[model samples]
Target: MARKRGLGRDDVVTAGLAVLDHAGIDAVSLAAVAERLDVRPPSLYAHVDGLAGLKRDLAHTTTVEFGEVLRDSVLGRSGPDAVRSFADAYRRWATGFPGRYEMTLLPIAADDDERRAGARLALGAVQAVIRGFGIDETSAIQAGRSLRSALDGFSRLENADNMGRGDHDADFAFLIDLLIDGISQAGTQPPGPA
Candidate 1:
């Protein structure tokens, strides 16, 4: 029994990630994780509050990991170069870790520490690109939203196999370039449109 009960919370999360990767989000459950760990369903309660809690924790973990990829890819880069790098990294991370990447999109409430750390990681990536334009904090935040939306939209579309006709990579590159140019022009534009 001691050997059978050796599983821990991290073990449950690890098993959950495996289930997510092998199957899909819908397939991950407390029972599934327990089965993977060869433990009783009740055993999970000691680790995760419930399925929602487990999923939230997984999402948070995945987001942090994704943020690290963005950080590493965009660091020390600037301007359009940084933008392209960040965009490419985002796509790559999502493609490479589809299960984990999907988790990042799930809406979940995070504690202060999780929220702050995740925000810093996410903002740090955005700031890397925005800093290139010498944008202010407010503008940086706005640009970050735009950047995230574009990347998220593109990744979601691609994941769904929704690209219609053109070459996906070429189209993605074009969009990234367009976004970089748009941000640059926005920086130079007057407060209001003419």
Candidate 2:
């Protein structure tokens, strides 16, 4: 097949993301991407190394995309109100883009600068919200993990179609309430052993 006249790496990544969002991660093969781009699989090699490389790139971009979702979700917001916005945004994005959201869970290697930065960008956004409750820097990491654990667990359950599906909004509101209450209490407590 003739190489597309103006194909580029970003085009490939965008095509991969489309395939992922439409099908799933497993469907983002080089052939699939190339077919979508109207190019041959080998044509992707000029832009991406291969399937593995393409997936790595996809993960990086997806992570950054999610971070942007988070940052935008809480812009000009603060405190528990920010937490509610953060959770709502998180759930909406995670459930809305199951395939891409899964990419955010991929492990970022030490040398994966782009991927690591993307993760930091995403997590740091949430951490910033966690810190809004007036928790100390040292304690915020633990608190952030706890809050993320709750959000991740709930989103995963909802994605799996296994949740009771009864009032996810109210359920998320209740989760945020528990989180806000706990964070408020934690901020007031003296440092204690984990």
Candidate 3:
């Protein structure tokens, strides 16, 4: 077998993601990634802190990639259009990389810059969509949370093959429509007596 001497941090992360894609997140371990790379687990310590650090790095990578896909999805779009685009793109990203998507949900420590950057990028897209509705920051935050929760929930169910025989596309579109209508209605309402 050829030597794995030049393997770097990225190589480890890439191997980890491949392991995830093939065997799900639970199967991703330092040993598994090292095995995929034909190297000993201890060799990975040069690139990653260990299993936990590998997971965090995977989360950071997937989140950043997801955010970029989201940002691109909403380009030149706003309001309901942007919302729909965002939802569609989000579903695409999540479903395409369900294992990696799960990684993005891993907890990030306070000082984790990569995780923070990835999260901020994803949130910025949502914030932009909310602002397009003329929603204030306080309300936008709530809206963002609601939108994310809905999207994530649906995607998780679908990724798990648990949509229960429903017409998945129709159900997703219906949810997206409901979300858009709610945001639009909220935008048209006056602030509660301040």
Q: What shift in Å separates residue 77 of candidate 3 from its native position after superposition?
A: 0.6
Q: Clashes in model 3: which pairs?
A: none
Q: Candidate 3's residue-wise lDDT over 1-194, tens digit each?
A: 35687889999999999998888899999989988999889999999999988988888888899889888888899989999999999999899989988988888889898789988888889988888999755667778888999999999999988889868999999999999988877776765322
The sequence of per-residue lDDT tens digits that candidate 1 reaches over residues 1-194 is: 23365667788889998988877788889888888887778778888989987897787777788878889888778899899989999998887667888887776465637845775787788888888997656666677788999998999888777888889999999999888887887677544321
TM-score of each: 0.88, 0.94, 0.93
Give the count of colliding residue pairs in each prediction: 0, 0, 0
Give model 2's TM-score versus the native structure.
0.94
Model 3: what TM-score?
Answer: 0.93
Worst 10 residues of 1 by lDDT: 185-194
lDDT of 2: 0.87
Local distance difference test values of all predictions, in order: 0.81, 0.87, 0.88
lDDT of 2 by residue, 1-194 (tens): 76678888999999999999999887889999988998888889999989989999999999989999998878888898888889899989999999999888988877899988888777877887887888876567777888889999999998888788488888888988999888888888885555
